[model samples]
Target: MKLYPIESGNFKLDGGAMFGVVPKSLWHRTNPADANNMIDIAARCLLIEDGNRLILIDTGMGDKQSDKFLGYYYLWGNDTIDKSLKKYGFHRDDITDVFMTHLHFDHCGGSVQWNKDRTGYEPAFKNALFWSNKDHWLWATQPNNREKASFLKENILPMEESGQLNFVSLPETEILKNSELGFDIFFANGHTDKQMIPIITYKDMKICFMADLLPTAGHLPLPYVMGYDTRPLLTLDEKEAFLNLAANDNFYLFLEHDAHNEIITVQHTEKGVRLKDVYSCSDLF
Candidate 1:
């Protein structure tokens, strides 16, 4: 199996929002904010090429949202799914499975795009089966007021409408082994309802797709949960358990929202699990 770090795009978000109640004085040290208090964020999706299947983890924020809507996030960068795919000599059409960690616009927005006629929306990957768990699919589609803004209809409904949407069966335990996508899934709920974190084994190394469960290296601290998370207290528990497991097992965390730090490993520190080493995608993949 071959893996590629797809640079979908980059944007800036309020540092305060990214690092919940954590004081700016603390988080700013690792994720320094600009004059506007906005920090750089990346939509770093992952692509896995295994035998006949080409699976994409997340699609990032697509270019279909209106300028006014996109402006709120302060989207920046030239990276697009097309350009990034081309870098690996592939295209969206080559993707057989688009497994989304969640339905947030920034994560799954690129899965759907405006049709050629501009009349309506359509699945971006014509030949791909968009993947989401039943719980997350229901949560996103019938979003609560707290997360309604993040779950846009245009970015979601088209996949189901196109008849290419599929649901991964939720495991009774925390981790689902040997999923249809050929990886283990770690179910996390603190960030959102049933956000699936993919645990992939490649080249004798366990590479975990750390979605919003651990957005950046700065978020390694258990209490440093995102303000956007609906259940911050629950997030603390999930992070503590997951971080300890990652540290003990020496898992390579593939951070999807960390613009600067691509991959990292954590070790048990006196202060609890902390960043051990940073690695470029080139170093591992």
Candidate 2:
């Protein structure tokens, strides 16, 4: 199986929100903020080339939102899904599955696009079966007040409307033992309800897609959690357990929102799980 890092785009998010209660004096040393106090973030997606299935994990925010809405995030960079796909000699149509980690707009917005007539939305990858777990699907569709802004309807709904939406069925409490794809699935709450983190076996190493579970290497510290998470305390517990497992097994974390660092590994340090080494995804292969 081959894995390609899809560079959808970059955007800025408030550093304070990204690092939760971690003081600016601490987080800023790693994720230095701009003059506006926003830090650079990447909507980096992953493409899996396995057999007849071309699975894409997370579609970055599409260009369908209004300028006003886009302005809030301060979108940056020319990298796009189309350009990224082309770099690998592929096209959006080649994607057979879109495995969404969650339904946040920045993560799944590229799933749908404005139709040619501009009358309504349509599946961005018409032939793809868009995947989301049942719990996350419900959580996003019927979002609570705190998360409503992040779960934009325009980024969702169209997949179901196009008859291409499907769910991965697993016990709410367990990791998916029977993955149809070639990856083991790790379910994480805290960040959001039932966010599926894919543990992919690529080459001789295992790579876990760190979708908000661990946004960047800077987030390796247990106390450094995102403020956006509904259950920050739950996130704390989840991160501790996950990091311990990751450090023991030496799993490479494929970061979704880290702009500079693409992949990272953690070590069991005296201070707790701490960043070990960083690399570009290609460096692994």
Candidate 3:
């Protein structure tokens, strides 16, 4: 199996929103904010090349939002979905599966695009079987008012309309057994309901798509939950339990939003599992 980091580009969000109730004086030292208090974040996706199944983890913030909407996030980057895929000798059409971590725009925006002549929204990868549990689908489609703006209909619906949407069984409360691919699913609610974190085994090492659970090294602290979370307290509980297991088993956290750091380790420190080191994903291979 081969893995590639698909650079879906970067966007900005209020640092306060990203780091939650943490004071600026505290988080600024870790992930510095711009003069406007907006912080740069990457929409990093993972591509799995296993047999004929080319699975893409998440789509980046697509270029479909209006200019005013783009102004808010300050989306700036040269690397795009197609460009990133081309780097690995693949194309959008080659993708066979799109495993949406959740329906948040930044995570799944690139899943669909405006049709030719700007007719209507359509599946970005027409051939890929887009995967999301029924629960997440319902949550995103009928989003709560608090998160309605982030769950843009233009980025969703088209997957089902394209007739390629599928749902994986929810993992049991107990640590899930690996699928045939030798990877287990870790569910966490801090970020979203039933968000699935793929625990992949490769080359005698374990790697997990940390998703929003541990977005970056700066987010290692138990108090660093994002203010954007619907249930910040629930995020706290979920993060602590997940981090403890990750530190104990020495898993490589494959960060989905960290632009500078790709993989990180957590040491069982007095303050709980603190980030031990940062390395590129290539180091894992």
Candidate 4:
């Protein structure tokens, strides 16, 4: 198995929203904000090449939203899925699976694109099976008022309409071992309903796709949950348990939203679990 870091794009978001109730004085130290109080964010997706199956985890924010809509996020950078795939000598058509951690526009938006005629939207990866769980699929499709803005219909629906959508079976326990995607899935709910965090084994080390469960190394603190999370209290519990496990087992966390820090590991400290080390994608994959 081979892993490639796919740089979809970069954008800036309000630091306050990203760090929730955490005081700017604290979070700003790690994730410094610009003059506009916006911090750099990355839609760093992951690509897995195992045998003939080329699986992509998250597609970033596609270039389909109107300028007005995209402007709100302060989009930056020249990275695109096409350019990143080409860097690895691959293309979207070579992807066999597009596994979405959640249906948020920034995570799965690139899964759909405007057709050649620009008449309607269509699946971005023509040959890929778009993956989501039944719970998250329903949660995103029938979104609540708070999350409605993040779940854009143009970024979704087309996968199912194209007859390429598939759902991973929900696990009875916190972790689902040996999933259909050839990895273990850690189910988390605090961020959103049934957010699936992929736990992959490579070279005898577990590389966990940290999704929103732990957006960045700065979010290692249990109470440093995102304001966007529906259940912030529940997020505290999930992070505590997951961080403990990650520290104990020495798991390499693959952060998807951290623009600067690519991969990191945590260790037990007097202040609880804290960042132990940082690594570039090349160090592991």
Instruction: Give the winner by lDDT.
Output: 1
The residue-by-residue lDDT of candidate 3 on 34-54, one tens digit each, is: 999988788889998888889
Q: Which ten-residue region of model 3 has the weakest summed lDDT?
A: 174-183
lDDT of 4 by residue, 1-285 (tens): 999999999999999999999999999999999999999998999999999999999999899999998999999889999999999999899999999999999999999999999999999999999999999999999999999999999888998899999999899899999889999999999989999999999988999999999998889988899999999999999999999999999999999999999999999999999999999999989
Considering summed lDDT, which 10 consecutive residues are worst modelled in model 2? 169-178
Q: TM-score for each prediction?
A: 0.99, 0.98, 0.96, 0.99
Q: lDDT for every model?
A: 0.95, 0.92, 0.85, 0.94
Flag regions of model 3 displaced more than 4 Å: 180-182
Residues 1-285 of candidate 1 have per-residue lDDT tens digits of 999999999999999999989999999999999999999999999999999999999999899999998898898889999999999999889999999999999999999999999999999999999999999999999999999999999999999999999999899999999999999999999999999999999999999999999999999988899999999999999999999999999999999999999999999989999999999999998
RMSD of each: 0.6, 0.9, 1.4, 0.6
Tell me how candidate 1 scores on lDDT. 0.95
Q: Where is model 2 more than 4 Å wrong at Cα?
A: none
